[model samples]
Target chain A: MFEKKRLHPISIISHIAKQLIDTLFPLLVLVVMKARTVSLGWNIAVPTVVLLYTTLIGFFTWLRFTYQLNERELCIEQGVFLRKKRSIPFERIQGISISAGFFQRLVGVVQVRIETAGNELGKAEAILTAVTKKEAEQIARQIRKVKEGVVHDETIELINRSEQPNDIVFSLRFRDVFLLSVTSGGVFGVLAAIAAFISQLDDFISYDALYRKVQALGFVRNTLSGVVAIFVLFVVAYAISVGRHLLRYAFFTVRKQEDMIVISRGLFEKQLLTVSRKRVQGIIIKENVVQRLLGYVSVHIIHAGGSLDGGESGSVVFCPFMKKERAASVIAACLPEYHIHHEFQALPQRARVRYMLRPVYVFAIPIGMVAYVLRPWGMGLLLLLPIVSYLGYKSYQMAGWAISANQLALRSGMFRIQTIYMLKYRIQSVATSATWLQKRKQLSTLAVAVMPKMFSKVTDVDEKEAEAVYTWMQ
Target chain B: MAQLSKRISERAVSVWRIYALIRFTIFLLVYIIVCFLLMKFDGPKWVVFLLAVLFLADLFLFVLLWPRWRWQRWRYDVREQEIEIEHGVWIIKRTLIPMSRVQHVDLKQGPLLKKYKLASITIFTAATVHEIPALDEQEAEKLRHVISAFVKVDDRDV
Candidate 1:
């Protein structure tokens, strides 16, 4: 079931570059030893052997690499002397994701990622590097046809139909991008840049020379120079932030495929990603305090096995800055099962008070001890009492759980609200707990276990209205 | 098809008492070691005395609570479509697992339980775990057979 074709010879160069980076530390030591004319037999012998070993590996990699695509499966046969064959059945292929870096783009090549369902480690079944953009898309379409066949229970169609996405769900204009960049985390970047510039003054000019020069200058001149430096740093940081945001998200477009959504963007190093509709666990619409004031929201979808580099990677910003209603409508269109409710259910006031009090009581003894030990400095630590109290109150207010016919949603986090959704069938387990006080108030916490493609196995609602939920589930 | 039925004989409470006694002995040994370290490190006499008192108080509380901890209380109800278990002290917890979700069931007997003709039944599910402890051998076997039959039944009804 496998036919062999030689991989592009450029793969050898890439492989060697990777090996060189890995052996860089040992190579540096060997170079220094030879330059010093220190003839340690083992030291010279070790590096000599390593160099030969690396070169032999590169040669064998170029010889044994081959990737073939048949009608029903894609096979890759690659090894040094011992051949290793990997076959991915057409039915099991989940999605194809394409990514290109600046260097790859310059060489007219992109990295193709093939993802599959089930299992946490190495869910990206295969990765093909340095493939032409046209060839990458062709392979992606063929894999998509196979995935659709499995979902719909049909044989593959031989026709090479160009798969065009349905509609652009969300896009950010230049003005929107600029507004978002300036009002969001831009001030911190500017301050960091100013600090970095001040630290680099010795690098730019000798410390002694700069100190003497500054002493020779008048107070007014020194003040003016400082102001100019600050102004230049602010401009540089702001420009860099805005430029980076625009370059990475210039033509961001998310379109609907048959049973999946495809996100494509970037002027250079373009990336195209597909996620099955069923795999999407939830949709998070975020609006920073500034974005909220300006009536804009950013939508992100949570999907299993959709990450590009294995950890929270497949986050596609469907819309950078759009009207809340418009964003909600698009989300509804894509995920018709989830209905956006105007009024979210909040925990009861009594429950909120108990939740806030529990943390305060838990920290009171330790806080008091620290205050006694520190004396005058302890006065500063007293401020933490109110901060902890406020966070507890906010967490209580933000925590809520809701269950629909087919899904369960748990909302948490104070400043950044995260609403996690899981299908009823996907839930591996449900655990409920009640602390001593919670038992008194008849309140309990519920944790729902889910098998995400990576990281945390469980997402829970702590100290929420659990009795009512327990009754409902029962 | 023929049906099988078995009855389980109840065991004595001395078995649980012995288990609690062993646990208490271990806790006492750990407490003594910690106290010895504190005294050897030149800790304040008053502080060491207060810790000793606290340790003694905890031991007394455990002794008083031993009966409640060792109480052989468990309930298992196998209905037409689900298995329900209610257990725990101070705070009771109830779990209901649909028969369709039960992957398997096991009947285990320890040396002490084997001598007393008693066994324990653990029902495995995809999501939840439930166990019935201190059941007589006949009841344990009957429960295991019934659960296995239900586990084999088609899950479509769930």
Candidate 2:
């Protein structure tokens, strides 16, 4: 048992910095308004009073916040006037993560985040924003020991505090990060962003000026400038994507400690994420069009709870980038139970025509309306037909499902193929649905729902096969 | 499975009609109040005409037609291991909920349901919820008991 103690004194500065960031807009407005209208004496008085008020609040917040860890629970007392005390037992704690940004690293402190299953409001239950690295590591080790059924009284052998042990089960190197950046479908996103920016740019800049200028130039010059503009755009987009990948995934590492998996990464804002094996619902292997051509894959782990971005599936990247050949080895090292090599049961031959019909029907309405409204110009939009039809065919070819004694595997998608492996016990429900057209055609769609609202569906399978799956899952 | 896909109890259709009747009464009340105010203040006639058109559409669709279609489409079946429900009129939807994943079962009766001696059973899982509406009170109670017992067994096995 440890006595109650306040966080490191450096936390006061961090608290003030956090408050400044939170109230930046109002503070900026105050300064601007004061400079424009207030007299010199009033200006000095107002700024001084605001600074004093914020500093007092930060100091009191630091003085009031205290935390303690015992054999069974971690208790925290916080809030100055409100006086909130929270106690979280070891059994209820789902995960403990640590983060240290630039300032925290400079001050030799780490931010500890505790997550519990009972977080109904979808936020960290407790966050100790400033603690020594040694204290953070000790807390993590103790939690892991408790989860592994080791008695707390036992004198555990301590390792070197300065170095994280050489126990990484999976890791991404510099080359892997580069490969992921190049092939992770950044081209489409960058193109979309560029398109949106160009549309909005019209509101800011008069493009008619440039158009008239271009028209005045010779034909060859205008064509040459157009090519140069496109080339520059491509270069800029690729550089930005690759740079983002490098910063976010620098020094990415995953380690297995008993029943827990700990992942830590990042160059600027370091993120440490812990996931309990018991809570992991499934694993998904994804490969975009470019990644597939380059023989690269990324692995994601799905679990119950809101994700880091408060989205569905709570999926985190287990492996950012790996070669096709290395993917099996990585899976074996991290999750041995998930079978990487298996023959999947594909959809029947009749499903091809049905699959081709789907995209045509989906694209028809827009095409029809555009042609009806815009006449000849909309007929040019019919060019999208070939692309959508090809996508539909590819989606049909990729859609498949297979089952084993303990696991079920489903593969779907057109441009980005996703193959998910889920333990049978994790499935909450399985269903088979068919629209009136499909009912007549004797084809159905099978949907299997897992926790955290991940619904895996394989479309255009034989009705009999869908029924068999429904009964088998039960 | 074949037998379970049939429509719910015959009484549920009457229950739906009564539910629609109450809604229609509320709609009528609001319409009369608005119409009275509009005429008193000499509002535009076109606005009142548009409101009347919308109200007529609502009355024909929700009060007159939808209840019968909904009754015909709604179906549910309770199996040993899972519950299956098929619902919706234009685009029918089917859902299956496994018994092992059921966290709890609830039987609820509002004032109308109580007057009619009917209940609705709601089954809850960690991430989602499903309900089978307008069953006989005794049947709803028995289904709740059975599902809870299955949930208890599942917990014990784990």
Give the best candidate by lDDT.
2
Instruction: For residues A1-474, write the lDDT of model 1, one tens digit per residue.
Output: 335666555666666767977787447645554544565775667777877888789878878777888877888888887888998887776656667655566676777777765333445787776677666666666666766644312111211121343465655666776776665543445577666655644243456865677689854576578679779877876676777667767667666656766666676656666566776655656555455567666777666554643435544455666777786588777778775543445666667776566677877889988887656556577777777788678777766777777676666654444455555554434445554565676565565544342111112233444544544443
- Cα deviation of A428 in candidate 2 (Å)? 1.1
Which pairs, if any, clash in model 2?
Answer: none
Against the true structure, candidate 2 reaches a TM-score of 0.76
Worst 10 residues of 2 chain A by lDDT: A153-162
Residue by residue across A154-264, what tens digits does model 2's lDDT show?
111212211366667878888888787777744576676556435533444447876787679854576577669767766766677778788888888887766666777
Candidate 1 docking category? incorrect
All candidates: CA RMSD (Å):
9.5, 6.4
Check candidate 1 and list the clashing pairs: none
How close is candidate 1 at the interface, in terms of C-alpha RMSD after superposing the true interface residues? 7.8
lDDT by residue for model 2 (B1-158), tens: 25355446667777888888898889889988998899999988788889889989888888778888888888888777888888877555677787788888889999888888889999877657888888888888988887777664454211
> Candidate 2's error at A127, in angstroms?
2.5
Look at candidate 1 and tell me the lDDT of residue B141.
93
